[model samples]
Target chain A: MDSDIRLLSDLAPGQQAVISAVHADEALHQRLVALGFRIGRNVLLMRRGRWAGPLQVRLGATDVMLRRAEAGLITVRAA
Target chain B: MKRIALLGMPNTGKSTLFNRLTGSSARVANWAGVTVDLASAKILLGGHMAEMVDLPGIYDLHGFSDDEKVVRHFLEAHAIDVLAVVVNATQIERQLPLVLQARSLGLPLVLLLNMADAAKRHGMQVDTARLAARLGLPVVMISAKYGTGQAEALRVLAHSLDAALEIGPARHAALKSVLSDDVRIERETAEMMAEAVTQPLLLPEQVSDRIDRLALHPWLGLPLFFVAMLVMFQAVFWLGAPLQQGLTGLFDQLRQSALEPLAAVLPDFVRGLLLDGVYAGFVTVAAFVPLIVLFFLFMALVEDSGYLARAAFLTDALMGKLGLDGRSFVMVLMGFGCNVPAVMGTRMMRERPLRLLSMLVIPLSLCSARLQVFLFIVSAIFRPAQAPWVIFGFYVASFATMILTALLFRGRFRNTEPFVVELPPWRVPTLRQVWMRGWLEVRHFLSRATRFIVLGVIAIWLLTNLPAGATPGSVATLAGQLGTLFAPILAPIGIDEKLTVALLFGFVAKEVMIGAFAVIYGLSGDALAHEFARNMNWVQAVSFMLFTLIYTPCMSTIATIKIESRSAAFAALSVLWPLALAWFTSFVFYQGMRLFIGG
Candidate 1:
């Protein structure tokens, strides 16, 4: 696991990270942006469910639950 | 009256402020998009009557979701006098872009920093003077939940409304062009947040975050959620039982004292109509008010406390396997109380397939109406000790059926939307707000009961009493004929002619099943229980409960399904599939029990 760059799913629960880039389609990208997920935004990987379930992440004051597959599309770096 | 539209990013306390301003209790939950349609109320603002419209929350004015489209169409169609943009003060960084977008819409604006108390508690200081100057709008700080600064907010809004100014065509085009640049908009919002806000050196952990740490824990979160639900259901029964019994006794007394006296003056048939048909049927549904109130009270608390979002997070994986999301689980839980609102609740889901699948499975939940009938049968046939477990087993079976139904239809629709939902901050819900919600729903239930329950009861009464001398609820009457026609088809499931007639009326409303039994047997309470005990063995009783659990939803549910789905074919399928499934499931259960236990 590279320290400089990793997928959002790689961030351990309670780990803080900053979004570096998003690798989804245009529509998903826009939706993510509208939810306050964007470059340079600080996000905390608050919790993840078992058996590769959805991940609950806190971005700004908003907490969002995203599927692991969707989480995988976001590239993040340790804050 | 001048119109003002309340607009904001999702979950900014917009609806709460709407209720505060208009004194109208629209549904206010912590989750986003709770207000799916436009809700309007007239209020006297600064002594001038004005209509306030609370539109569904939207992320962006140019967003493509259904809620956004609704807001867009509304702004285009209605000449709103003032656009009151409610911003969550604690999340000003994320909410400012929406405020800016609404500003660009060329409408006169008043900025309301709602949840100001929560923001102050977070150690965030918002310079309203600077913000007002920066945004070129009147800014008012208020706590919608606690009703703080409401008079100031109303005064500011009235002043803004009176001095409305329309945006010039050139300025509108330029503002639109500027908003189209997403990167620049984000940059500008960040800059604005930095200038107009100050934060403490050491920020405290949010109460919501601290709770979510345990509530959303990987290993313990699910168990905790289930325990919470178990407590809720137990509380519903423990607290609701006495009140339910009292209401039932009161209605019984009314029938005996008021309606029974009418027998002397009126003809016997008319006396029977007033007492047996009208009062019995109405009380049968109305007596469940306590149970309904408790259920909604708990539901409102869980939703307003922001726990439901964590529940959604906990269950998303399991729901994903069924081709649905965790929010659908909330709707299904609501179905346990009533299928009507549960079906309507699908509006919270933005995806068509998920909404449709949720609607399809909601009818299978063991609603309180069905639960009442099940309780009657189980208590009469099984021992008191075994009654609770028997009822629990029926609920387990209902869930199994709902899951199997979802799995069977998963291939028919595409899962377009990913699981992305906001976990709103936890708040101590005000009792007034909770009670207002409960009262509103109770009012809705009474109105629906008046329309469907009364009409259905009168029709059944006429069928059983027409042809003047025919024996009531016997083969010579129309109800009996209809029951006889359906009895052979239901015979394999252990439903006899009298039970079949009751089942026919049960289609009108499941609560009517007990009342129908009372009518058919001409018995009540202990006598009715005795009749049930003599007629039904344990195996037949279990089979009958199974049939009731899986069979077609009551008439009101079907009508709601038709309206929500907007498809005649889907409604027809809703009826046919459940009937088929019920028959097959009941037949299997009855045969299996008979073989193992040796009837």
Candidate 2:
């Protein structure tokens, strides 16, 4: 992965980043977009559960929890 | 009547606004997709009756998800007079694209800036007039939670309905210019937010964030969740016990003073039917009303506080291991209250396979009805100090069965949707909302389960008293014969003929199992305990509780599964799978304990 593009799952808890792209299927991609995870939106990695658990991310005023595999589909750059 | 639909993104207080406008107590949580189906009620707007439909929350009208499809199909199928687009004012930027999409559909629309109080608290000043002018629609700012601008919104809706009817087909032709691609829609929404919404440049930490810092902590969060659940269970028992006891005593008094006197005037069979059959059965299930109410109260509080989403967040990984999602975890938790609603709650999941899988596992959740039976057995078999742990063990087993069932059946279903859940801002639950929810749930329970319970009791009574000469509930009666027929199937699990008869009645409702014991043994309270102690050892008691924990779901749940899944095969599998699992589990427990303890 490029320096500016890494999986959202790789972001440390409490780290803020901007979503570069969401590389998932049409359904998942649309869901992410519907949830305000559109390109260039600032997302904060709020919390990561233990043992590779779901990653809680904040998009705008909304907070969402996504599984690690799902989070891995979103590429982001550190903000 | 004109049809006005309440449309909004998920978690935007659309259902709450609907409740406020229509006075219908549809389930409202601080999370998304609580209203999974279309709910409508007739409301008097300006002294004119209009049917107000509460559509499932959707982010975009063009979206392909189940809820979105339902909303789209509803709009396409029905002639909606007005579209009330509810926007969470605090997140207006993210919500505007949907409003734009609805605008493109050229329905006479009214934009409701809901949660205006929360918006102000967040230091957001939504320029509703400018946005309304820009979108060429009526915009009303309202706080659905506090009923601040609902009347104004309704007035606007009525005016817009009349105005749109005046404009008629011309508006659709002119609106073609407004319809654009997603990119343009996003751009327009961004520009609108920039021009209209004013917020603090640097947002300060919110109460919800502060709480989530601790509640969602990877290490402490899980334990805190468990402790919170334990407290809820304890509250259910501690708060409910006194009320339960009082109700029981009151019913007993009523049976003796009010019902027993009927024996002098009424015939013997009539007295038996009224007092022993109807009254006993009703009271047995009715006594758990307090416990069920408290359970739902605690659940409502947790759900309203937004902790359920966090709990889902915490459990998603583990649930993913079983090919389920975190929302499924929440549904299973709800199953502890009742499997019927929990199965219905599966509609919140957008995916078909996940919904079906969730429906399959929910019945094994050891609902409050089954918990009542276990509580009876535990109180009778174990010391008071040990009773909580014994009950907790059953809960643990229930959770294990839920997870194991999910894992076992995962291969049968395809995993399509990924885990995605919104964490709504935590709000202090109001007493009125809590009371209304608890009351509604209790009412629902009574309406759905009571008829079945009474019918089952009448049937059992008839069976025990039949053939004219057979002793009631004795080995010679019809019930006894039925019990003997099922006895061999239950014998390996250490259930005798009497208990077999009780389990058979339990198929109607689990709470009836305890009542069946009372009727068959002709015992209650200490006498019932003494009888159980004489007939069964501790190992058998443990095995019996385990068997009850995993056995076939009560009759209502099976019917719900059939209706909800629209498949009789799914319902049959639900029953057969649990019965087989229950038998195997109890057989193991009984054999293992007996081998070690010397039966």
Candidate 1: interface RMSD equals 10.9
Candidate 2, residues B1-599, lDDT tens digits: the string is 78798898877777567767876323211223222334566877766788887776787776656566567656655667899999989889999999988987878889999989988999999888899899999999999889999789989988877765666655544443333343355457679889997532322448678888788786889899999998888888888888987987888888779777767698888887777777776776677778788888888778776788888888887888887888888988888878889999888787888888988989999888888888878877888788888899899999888888988899997676788777777777777777887778778776766766777777777877776788888778888888789888888898877777778878888867777766666555556667888888878898888988889998889999999989999999999999999999999999888888888
Best model number under TM-score: 2
Where does model 2 sit among the CAPRI classes?
Answer: acceptable
Model 1 spans > 4 angstroms off: A1-3, B1-207
Tell me the DockQ of each model, to 2 decimals. Answer: 0.33, 0.36
Quality of candidate 1 docking, DockQ: 0.33
Model 1 residue pairs with clashes: none
Error of 1 at B17 (Å): 37
Candidate 1 structure quality by residue, lDDT tens digits, B1-599: 68788888766767567756775223221223232334576888766888788776688887656567667656654567888999989999999998888887767899999889989999999999999999999899999889998999999988877776343345444544543554355457679879996532222457667787788788999999878877786677778867877887887787778767767698888778867777676676676668777877887777777787788888889988998888888788778878999999998676777788888889999987787788778868988657767877887898899889889988885576777777767777777767887777667766765676677666777777767889987888887787788877887788877788668777888877776666666656556678889988988988988998889999899999999989988888888888889999999988888889887
What RMSD does model 1 have?
A: 16.8
TM-score of chain B of each: 0.65, 0.67
